[model samples]
Target: MATAHTHVTKQQAPPHRAAELSAFGVLILLAGAFLPIMDFFITNVALPSIDTSLHASAASLQLVIAGYGVAYAALLVLGGRLGDSYGRRRLFLIALVGFVLASLACGLAPGVGVLIAARIVQGATAALLVPQVLATFHHALEGERKARALGLYGATSGIAAVVGQLVGGLLVGADIAGTSWRPIFLVNVPIGLVVLLVAARIVPGTRSEHPVGVDVPGTVLFAATLVTLLVPLTEGHSLGWPWWTWVLLALAVILGAVTYGVEKRAERRGEVPLLPPSLLRLPSMSRGLVMVLAFSIGFGAFMFVFALTVQDGLHADALHGGLAILPMALLFFAGSVVAPRLLSRFGRAAMSAGAVLQLAGLAWLVAVLLADWPHVYLWAMAAPMALAGAGQSVLFAGLFRSVLADVPAHLGGIGSGALITLQQSGLALGVATLGTVYIGLAPHGASHAFAAVEYVHMGIVALLAVGVAALPRFTRATPVTPVTES
Candidate 1:
């Protein structure tokens, strides 16, 4: 149950003045949404170059990846709460500025330690900035406009993952005056500066009227739980599954229980818990998260594992490795652009179709890879990749809308935060688990290992398809709207 403190606060201005977002404002928000996701995947192809340059061990390399991801995932809910309490525009600019600086630090770091430290800060700031984009859209847009805006957001997400790798490959190949992988992070500086300028001018400020109390104990316990779970998973293979790994995993379970207890207590006290347990009662939100976890696991595993397989197994150059995914990326963009229109007609059928297509693509890919093996080139992989990308585009384009269809506007920040938290967690866990599986098997043979993982991913896609089939279809009568604060 919502507390007495949860009522809407007085508006700073008239309602209409606060309600609308200009077109340029939407563009600026999309840019904000795009960069962080791109950065997440950009480093994939560059990891080998980084290891060579820094002489870093396998464990340290995993840290570089997991440190950014873990911090981002753990703090996302708190980040959302901060924006909800403060002004979203205010927090967004602050995080963006910090993101630019962190990128610079990551670019200039002399060693793995410094790079890892800088990346953690980078991810934390991303946690702060990303939710604001969606929350802002949820608040400012309505009806068809909202659907369109969300489709863009979904498209941007899929595009960034592919582009990150593409850009990483290009930057590494260009060597940008012999700086090599450093240029990938440094490239964000100018783009960020531009985004900050536009955002300051156009991004309207909005926050919940209700005063939100910081749930400190809940936040701490949540962070501890994620760290314990993610760290051990990410590092276990590199560290040879040390005794501490099992200890940390066990600790994660205890921390999770303690977190639940703390949240329940906060609810009894009529306080705003970090992630309101009550919100999970929303059936659409709950089911959508399940689909998010399943889809993201497949998506995340595909990107990380594909990069390694192409570059290491096939001995493809960084440019070639990045280009290999281009068909999927292009088709994904097309599918995302087309999905909003389809949703109006087919509703949840689009998602089911997407799932089917993705499964088909995976099956096709596995067969081709198995048949072609060492002889496979970018062209040979293009057909299945395009199909898979198109399918992914359709699935993600509608997922956010389906999830938030029932969420109230007042809880937009927390809702968006919750969605992204699950997404990042899925990504992290996918890498930790599937990545470990592939990495473990690589010593035997790279192609065979990659093919083995593809089969596993096929099963994951099939499971996600079943989940999509179960989602309630959207209808004209069930229009998507922002939930107003009580």
Candidate 2:
């Protein structure tokens, strides 16, 4: 009996230890994922403070935001490839340290030029870290555990957007140490340090079993494509639609075509491309990427518009603006917590249901906006906001899962990078497009402009509902091929 008992204990030990480690590692990776996204939105609330403090020109201020986004989006695929070629753990740590140093530089910069430069560096480092989070989860976890982790990842993403605004407002409002907006960037220092120490101990070093070499030409072309495309959209309006903006837009189209052709040729030559065309050819990947783009566009647009409505239109302070959306943030978390269970029971249908719910919530909110107009109270918007948040949470997780469902494990890093790159691009596009619409119409009437935006959001969500509903119920996995490193 004693021998039998000892044998059982020995047999159980490894699995138990692994489970604990997996959970802790996920927490660390999620922390890494959270900071980059949070930093993106956190600065939104602090922008006014920054402008006042630095006496920044409008163009430089726009650069402060656009620069970070463009850098992050452009280099994401390269970051993923590096993690795959070298090691995810190594790259994650290196990127985390870079992110921390960049954050510090942003916080302490003596002038706006230095701040913009640091922000771009901060975004570039974030690209290096964030993709590893998803790739590691894909490579390491499986089945139910994978589902739950993905759900949590979706939750972390949604929550970070809201928390960024909330924390930024609070920090600016409190004026910690009389530093005003600086605390928003500086706070990342301690949190990042703690995560770094813990991650070193727990996060397993994982990389692609068949690593792909970095494709330099493809990388440069892709980066150029995104920079030309995103820069004009983000800055065109503020710069009063300069002739150069149109020229860059035209260049972006040509560059994008060239990049695709280069990547395809590389694949044909039996070289690993930065983004493999064959990977995008997978039905699950292509279709799910579209959904991700649409969802992100709506989300980004709504968040940007709502913040302006509360702060500029309603004349609320930063803290109050953040507070108005607290219900949405809380419910979003709750929905994410419940999403894995729903997916287990309902399969792909769960995503459709989530979209439907989101549409309903949007419709409700739009009605309230139309009815109350300028007189709308914060509490009046709470119910619909919460409903929409929960729906978005479910849809986000489901979409994330679907996108990678057919991707082979060996390609997880590049696949994850593609997923996030589209997501970030959608966000920037959303802000540029719908945000422009809102801003243009605001002078006519803030309430009317907001209502118009919400109507567009409903249309987007309604289409999303149809798209998710039409997705194939099952995904066939892509087969992996062994490649000898050249």
Candidate 3:
């Protein structure tokens, strides 16, 4: 009897040990997280260079941008599930390797078609990589450590947005190796390789306590639904809003309904679905997702539209265009850095305050645009941009923290995946819907088109602020903790 008891104790030991993460390890993980996000923003700045060099048509340029996004958004949940079922660290490494190879292909591609294909693959690889980062932080660290890590993650989002554009501008202008815009993709090779080498050693492995096989049927349906919805929205304006676009949109709705039904059935059958319906019912998660979606749409649209308006409309070069967004990025970093302390003091009110600041910034931008018209430059736009950035920083920091605060540890991968999927989808949708509006209005004038879209973005921020008011406040007393491995 004593021997059997000892054996049982041994069996429990591995599951009982709480994982701890080091600062260096967190940096490594954040670096991996930063890569894909940085790529997305960098590509925004590189678009014109790509267009001029590749001679890409309008529709093709849209594809270059939307292709990566569609693929990433569609498969993200599946990637998260794969990490949970197998090993988060393992999946992350595999995805990084794929990202490196795909980035190489993108840099070397001789034509628009190859570049688009490479970019789609690159996006798909990013899907596999992202959830693992959040899941690691969720499972490995506890208490203040977890909060600090999360704060840094939020800051990285804004920092990458700024750095990506800045780097893209510099790289394209430099034309290193006489390859215009190629360095943007190629540059990832060395950094990714270094991260890959160190990650295997530094990154901890974590998976769901109750691992399950891949839900093939659910993955297929989910992918189909996203593809159908995003494809038409992305390409429609460039394609003259074809009848097929509407058809695809309708099919997306049908597929989405079907996907839900299938997931519900899977839950009833005691089988794991891509996203558990019950998970969505969690008050913290659901409410946070709503706010996140709205905020992301505004952010995504603002970035894409603003870049085009400044560069194409105002005839600013890539460097100047990127510089124009610098103030926002800088202030965003500041807001993220102070967010933890702010949250501790003000709780969810911090997010609401962020929304108000963002609204003010948008109003300011409209005023500046009206006053300066075609004469506007980076210095002229600094104040409003900084205001908007600070607002976005606080809003994102709070929303990300609040959403995952109550997630069950075993569901970390799935929860992280769901949150990110919504965010990415929001980003894609913003680019599609708001981008289409801006393009349609472009004939009137760049300033007119930009002002109109800014209003739309402002409306989204206002709604997000109201949503923040309703979110449950997070306190230091209620720290995010991991569940038992069993």
Q: Count the backbone clashes (under 3 Å) in each candidate.
A: 2, 0, 0
Q: Mark the regions of model 2 whose C-alpha exceeds 4 Å error after superposition.
A: 1-22, 55-63, 137-151, 475-486
Candidates' C-alpha lDDT:
0.79, 0.77, 0.79
- Candidate 2 per-residue lDDT over residues 1-486, each given as its tens digit: 233123222322221112233787888889988999898788777766787899885456556766787788778877877886787778989999999999999999889999999999998999888877766776667776775676567778778987888888888888878897899899999999999999888887776654556789987998888788877876777679999999999999999999999988877766667777888888877898898899988887788778777766777777776777788888888887887678767867888889888888878887887788777788898998888988988888788767877766545545666787788877767766777777778779877888888888888888887888655564422211111110
TM-score of every candidate relative to the true structure: 0.92, 0.87, 0.91
lDDT of 1 by residue, 242-268 (tens): 999999999999999999888877866
Sorted on TM-score, best first, the list reads 1, 3, 2
Error in Å for residue 73 of model 2: 2.1
RMSD after CA superposition, every candidate: 2.9, 8.0, 4.8
Cα distance off (Å), candidate 3, residue 106: 1.1
- Superposed by TM-score, candidate 3 places the C-alpha of residue 379 at a distance from the truth, in angstroms, of 0.6
Model 3 lDDT per residue over 1-486, tens place: 233123223333233223576789899989998988888778777777888899986667666767787788778777776776778889999999999999999999999999999999999999888767766777777777887776677678668977788788778768787887899999999999999999898888887655456678888898888789877877788788899999999999999999999987776666656777877778878888888888878787788888888778888777777778888878988887787788878988888899899899988987898788888866888999999889878877788778877666555545666777787878877777787788789878988898999998998888888887777767852332221122
